[model samples]
Target: MRRFRARHNASARPGRSALTSEVGWFVVIGVASTVGQALLYWVMRHWSPPVLANLASLLVVTVLNTEANRRLTFRGSPVRAVQAHLAAGGLFVLAYVITSGAVLLFRHYRPTASPAAETLVLAPAFALVTVVRFIVLRLVVFRRRNR
Candidate 1:
């Protein structure tokens, strides 16, 4: 564990690693962003298919989410933020897959899932992606020494 910390600088921020604090901040931002996405998905679910509505919500939120994590959670440069976004493209697709798959599965099984149900299903999916995002951002996107 000590060697791991030494190599990764895992505890750079006093007691806990900067990554740990950043993940706490990321959860804060993620909840807010998920709320926004849910509201948008609920609104757009009327006009679009549930999966498509989710994609639309993600489209609107991803940039904002990335930027917020970049500035607030990661404390990274704008240039590096852009690089993070580029790296995050795959993860975004992964998130979309998780979310859209959940919606699609509910609809397929229920065949008449409500908007509320769609939104409800998203809760778990978002939770899953949030962890993935944190790990990826910590190891790949904003490792402190990467600067």
Candidate 2:
């Protein structure tokens, strides 16, 4: 009985630890990506329309974020780099729609709002998208390589 219990506990540790590690790395990468995108958006907005700026910034950061997640967060995943980017492309479109819509809505309500205000509106949208991105990346994009 004691030996069986020890084996069971030991066997369970890897899955739990892998998940915890993935979550930790995902968050670290996500926050970095978020800051990067936000800064890019700020810089781009000075010349382009808000929606276009948002699109460009997201495009840049999405590529970077997917690669980071693949290398660090989902290390050992069997999915090839191209396939991961394909999946991440879909996620990028979703994020762009959500965030750009937030910007548009903010503008509609506050037409005189500054660039900072637009970014503020995007913050919650980014937060929501981050949670969804993690779930999809884990269950769909990476889908875990066989141990």
Candidate 3:
């Protein structure tokens, strides 16, 4: 048993370990993005269209997240990093669309609910989308190009 365990530990590649570490870094980036979005929302509360706030927040978060994910998370080759960043940005846009559609559907179904109430429910839905985004980034976009 001890020999098996030692062998298993020794067989783990540094590349695989880095991928795991990247997920941890991505979580931190997600939290930061959430905070940035909240701050943008608070600042833009007076705007007629609140979605503008979300867009602005998404822009800010995307740049920050891309930089952090490139440097700290995946640590892919320069070519791969650039490609992954672009792909991930596109995915984020798709996530936004999905999240917005879901929120609108919720509002339509629950017409009696206040905007705040609907937003509260939609927050977690967006969070779920974010998780999907991370998985795509990790598995598809930022996946290391095996040399």
* Candidate closest to the true structure, highest TM-score: 2
**2 versus 3: better TM-score goes to:** 2
In model 3, which runs have C-alpha deviations exceeding 4 angstroms? 1-5, 13-16, 106-119
* Candidate models: Cα lDDT each: 0.82, 0.90, 0.66
Better of 1 and 3 by lDDT: 1
Estimate the TM-score for candidate 3: 0.74
Task: Report per-prediction Cα RMSD to one decimal.
Answer: 4.5, 1.2, 3.2
lDDT by residue for model 3 over 65-99, one digit each (tens)? 77777777666545465676688778769756765
Worst 10 residues of 1 by lDDT: 10-19
The TM-score ranking, best first, is 2, 1, 3
TM-scores for every predicted model: 0.83, 0.95, 0.74
Best by lDDT: 2
Q: After superposition, how far is residue 140 of candidate 1 from its true place, in Å?
A: 0.4
lDDT accuracy of residue 109 in candidate 1: 93
User: What RMSD does model 2 have?
Assistant: 1.2
User: What lDDT is reached at residue 68 by model 1?
Assistant: 87
